[model samples]
Target: MPEAIHTLRVALPPEAVWDFVKDMNKWAPMLTGYQKHTIVTETKSLWTLKGDVGILSRTVELEVNITEWAGPDRVRFTLTGLNEAVSGEGQFEIRAIAVAGSAAAAAAASAPVAAKAELSWWQKLVERFARWFLGRQGGGQAALPAAPRAAVTAGSELAFTLMMEAGGPTAPLVNAMLEPALIPATEDLAQRIVTHLEKQHGLG
Candidate 1:
């Protein structure tokens, strides 16, 4: 099956990023479709998500398992639908860029960063399409505006990306049908999540 991917970089130390990503209890709700989630263990979780697909609105439930948990650098997980028809895996990777050193040194010696996420194939596709459309529109949708990049500090930057794949092969079509409602909804959710995180860390 095709996979959709989204990435976001934040201006935070690797440890800080890892801490936020490692704990699903804190960040899962940041997702646009997020409804509720429960941690089954350090490596397992259950999720409920609500969103629209074309003209159809739905609430989906799924299970997620952490396959890799390399702190301050990367996280990987697989999502399985509990009452839906979706299954997929995704990962978050953080790379640091520095301003004072040579490109090679900066790349090799930048600050540590971390990311965490849980999503299904269908959800990923919808998110990818929304982003593509938003980028083409130049960011003026009232509900879903373009995501703004922020400087972590004087020379560091933070960015966030989200992609969700629908439950089946027809997800792209479904997403397209729901574009009118989804775009604004997505933008609103994205902005809120960013705002919440920044406030949480005193970066807002």
Candidate 2:
């Protein structure tokens, strides 16, 4: 199985993130290759995505079922491929930022420095794909706010974790192709959610 987990500090409270994430419709389009989604019931939906694997792109249909919905904390879901042999599970977790005087808080503040380490080849490829997909060639026009209007002291943290696996004869090749894109996909969704919240709250 291939899994990707991305966590980032958001300048909003846990409840705020929950308010948005509770409704999949709000963030569904934020996905990297989102085409559309249909809600079948409170806990079931169908998603259509046009994903790029290496140099080839194809449309994928997935059945998403909510496994758990814990307010202001987490939402867990399982994915079943309708038109392909794939399955996975994912979750979104929101929590208060590390306590101010705790070692965790200090480490949280230093996370950016640690993240500045070198990137792997696949990571570099993912970056290029993202830039191209977003239609920005070398820092094009700015769209979002340059900076948040105010600093957030008691903010929250958001984490998204996803795991996927392909089955059958071609599973090996399909999984290999999917490996590079998973991390970026998770990251893009988490960042977009945070950005949208910041903008809505007038922080951006």
Q: Largest lDDT belongs to which candidate? A: 2
What's the C-alpha lDDT at position 18 in model 2? 94
- Highest TM-score against the true fold, candidate: 2
> Candidate 1: lDDT of 141?
25
Error of 2 at 17 (Å): 0.7
Against the true structure, what is every candidate's RMSD? 10.7, 10.6
Q: Model 2, residue 46: displacement in angstroms?
A: 0.4
Candidate 1 runs further than 4 Å off: 99-194
lDDT by residue (76-195, candidate 1, tens digit) is: 888787886666666665544222223222232222221213355576677567656865674322122112342213122232323345567777775455444433443443345434
Q: How close is candidate 2 to the true structure, as a TM-score?
A: 0.74
lDDT for each of the candidates? 0.53, 0.73
Using all chains and alpha carbons, the TM-scores for the candidates as numbered come to: 0.57, 0.74
